[model samples]
Target: MFLAQSFVFSLLAITGLALPSNEGVKHNNMARSTKYAPKEPPLTTPWTDKVGTKPWPEYPRPLLQRSDWKNLNGIWKYQNASDLNAVDSPPFGKDLAQEVLIPSCIESGLSGIQTDWGLYSWFSTSFDVSSEWKNDKVLLNFGAVDYEATVFVNGQKAGFHRGGYYRFALDVTEHVKFDQSNELLVFVHDPTDDGDYVIPIGKQTLRPSHIFYTPCSGIWQSVWLEAAPTNYITQLDLDANMDGQVNVTVHSSANGTSAQAKVTVHKDGKTVATHEGPTNKPFQFTVSSPKLWSPDSPNLYNVTVSLDKDEVESYIGFRTISRGVIDGVERPLLNGEFIFMFGTLDQGYWPDGLYTPPNHEAMVYDLKVLKDLGFNMVRKHIKVETDLFYRACDEIGLLVIQDMPSLRPLQSVLPDAKQQAEFARQLDVLVNQFKSYPSIAIWVIYNEGWGQITDTYPEFELTDRVRQLDPTRLVDSTTGWVDHGAGDFSDNHHYANPQCGTPFYSTASSPYDPSRIGFQGEFGGIGNNVSIEHLWNNQAAIDTINQTYEIDTTIEAWNYRSHLLLGELEDQIRLFACSGGVWTQTTDVEGEVNGLITYDRRVSRVDEKQWKADIQALYDAAAARSSNSTRDSL
Candidate 1:
């Protein structure tokens, strides 16, 4: 059911997904409110009775996994006031006008409370801690809050957090009523894009169109509670090697003092391994030629941890990620071989959820869909995701290119003297937040030129900050057009075509100090839009066709259309066998309409054969010298 022009495009796309993306977009309205739009639907809906209660309550963090956390997710009282200084009264009193949904932002429809003015919104909830956790410390957990947030337990401010992307905790043992229902109130303010904070907001707009959507305002992540002993583990950065030995540096609340840690590994629900040691010593364990973790085979070993006086749980994968000379060019070596990170520029957005995913399943669906279609990594463009998203990637074996949400006004990239100092403060905060996540192998500083101005100087400053934060993982100083001549990777963003800017790939500073790795951070955005079933339909937006597409560029048709794109992508990918390319993205976002798959994930544009062939070729070329000899020979 493909029309002539679409068919022609299909043929061309089959030859390759070669349309370049580097062409600078006409600076226009799209960028203004892109992140403001509600994104895609969820695999599960809390609104519907078709399914029972959403099962996400099972402790969101499966890595530093916990079995005894309380999910404060469902219902809550929310109201948006003109400003923080509002009518004097607790929410749900006669003073408030309406009720809002929990977990969904006030700007979202599902939230049951969408506000016009970016005002001060308040959320209040109450729950009783289980009697079993009485002796244990009660900790309030917020997966994320938009910009600035102050948390109160029993009407008393326990603690406050500023960054909206990373999770934060408050020891509410003193504030919560153990025997009675304890009330929790959270106040959030997100000056999304408009406000001058260093959040990495990509394509968020006040009015959505093309590549821009709605901005995620207010509390966009999850809220919950957990029970921990006086001493609990904070972060666990796990690393492994092909020989089957794993290493971990457990960051706990108590530092400088000698500590003991008991690590247990699990499969399914049963414990298959265990490791106990002193924090002063490296916690080591050996598995016999274990199933290595990969995008396809996301094998994870559960870890139940017991710190000297604390008992916590987490997980680990016995896989090794390294960088060495492959065919004379330096690239990432996974399990001792080069595995080209064919990925997407995932500006995690939703038509319905904005920054907050409509459902937990929606959160994990993109990675599963992309992995199914053939992709190993996702450059989490700009915005940072919840712990669940990272948990999904870690468990499912999807590599992450985690970018710190950039600051706004698009001028923060070249921070002024005043802002430059603030930049360090913010960067330091960001690094301390997610540095421990193992899947985050690369830390991207600025994306394109949005916030960047003073070319390499700002970049080097930023790069130096990241290296100072965590020395293990690699750093991509900037993801797009600018090069800092610092960081761990010579990264670049080229649209419509694939290239690592080979000229900069080899010298001591060629790949940004020659000692670093070279990566195609962004490229391959040749878009052939299928009008039908699009999240943002041009016809619908202009108030036109609701009729069925005669051309039917539906998933089936588009998948058929993929043959051309895949072949082209394959050819481009093959050109740099040794050097790797991170494809434009895993899923479609807004109007910059080129994706191997659709935004909703219901449609796949790349034909399966062509997609696999191109991917296999890239994998073969890059991983020809890996432990998986078959992959190398392919």
Candidate 2:
């Protein structure tokens, strides 16, 4: 009934008519047509709010924010291609008859068009370019578009992007009409598990029965426009060294090769350091007394960069991450100190928005809960999130283990060159997109054996590529199952307990052996209870290895069961002597109730206070070991 009313309100607003009072009339799902209103199961989060004209109005890129940008994320005209071939043609004059919400996946309930099977989706909208931006170049940015996207601005092809995860931008200055309104049309094609392409699908299958959930297709992220000077700063990379030095690399674009970059670092709004260098070269700077970034003290310094006629603001946190021997155990070190990463596998799924969060506050709430439960890290499983999500992790002081979304067909033994190259290219793009975020401490190139199925895994090649791209952070070539002796650490996945003990603490047998630091990439998938009211599929089998309480639905019973499950994690961390341990999940995804929190974010299965205390005790023990290790070395 709630969904039906929302649809009615949407239709009235789209047709430029006011909604009537909601008094006695009741509207049912049977009356609404799927063409106008999709028939999806009604599920909502507490963060659900009336999406006004401009949804997600916050600056999409918080780290590099500007005041001159305009948000293009409100209602957009959309049309699903009746014929797949129609997508190849430009959608300049074609009429988009249906209305859809921007930035939300079409399969999600919040999108207002919940049909997910469409291979080609077209979006068109008119936006005005401010006259103040006449002297600048107009840049159109898409936070993300799934699978493949071809963009057209005012009847001209502007740009094309292949990967669905990372952010991309196109200079629309040549395609835009400065004084008049500009028409923007984007065509997105996503072959999600349909066998048309072998790409990273990441827990999305067409037949989402047990472990997998629904597929997110087309424009699942924000789209916006920014006006920048013709000569602008394109990218910035910052690496903090353990010796109190930071390497700053800046890339800039200009009409000629004479542009130089001037950078200034500010601490507490006071200038601390400054450097001027060529746009193509890196600039090194040092501080007298550096304040490192950690869960305890997340100190960040603001920076401003200027090149020719452009200037942008950015911030960085000084920290170093590596793997080393500590207390006779191989462990991950942060800021020259060994730290055990106790985290959860965050799938980044929502009950309402599927891929996109309902609002910025919704994203913040997830991080807050993780921190409240005494977690120091989050292994972002398989999926690459928006820049805002990474920013939230940085601000909230949560370390990240970013995983490359797995390409499907795990059992296959042969490697395809085209798929392999595409995967590598996308991995490079992912690193370039998120390298500026200090929260990301490790990168997982492949998950289990999904994409790395060959006898000799090619992850060594991918791992080498990632290192060449960004050598500051550590890399786990493959998370679990079938190690081909590459990357910085060895990973194991087990249920309830990790069996690969002690060997990882010793020296490597061969110099080429990459399995040194042991990490429990995935474990402890314990399901407590399934809330029938919030179940996406009640009949679906619970997707977990260990079921704590098969039939317990009461809060008391679920809490008791979850307490025991979380307690097991503390023992597993020490018993395995792991550098890091990521729990099965942070929240329950569809058809899977193994998360510590419920699917709707309404209930935590365990007592928060007790869970925090237990996790904190483990953290205390790990710190003590690190201190002892330092003393022994001295």
Q: State each model's CA lDDT, in order.
A: 0.61, 0.75
Tell me the alpha-carbon RMSD of every candidate: 10.5, 6.3
Candidate 1 CA-lDDT value? 0.61
Best by lDDT: 2
Model 1, 109-196: lDDT tens digits are 4554444234466666678987788788888887777767877777677887876676787888988776687877777766555544
Q: In every candidate, how many clashes are there?
A: 62, 0
The worst-scoring run of ten residues by lDDT in candidate 2 lies at 505-514
At residue 173, candidate 1 shows an lDDT of 90
- Candidate 2 lDDT tens digits, 502-557: 33321211221323776777766666665476655324434432233243467677
The Cα error of candidate 2 at residue 425, in Å, is 0.5
The TM-scores of all predictions, comma-separated, are 0.79, 0.89
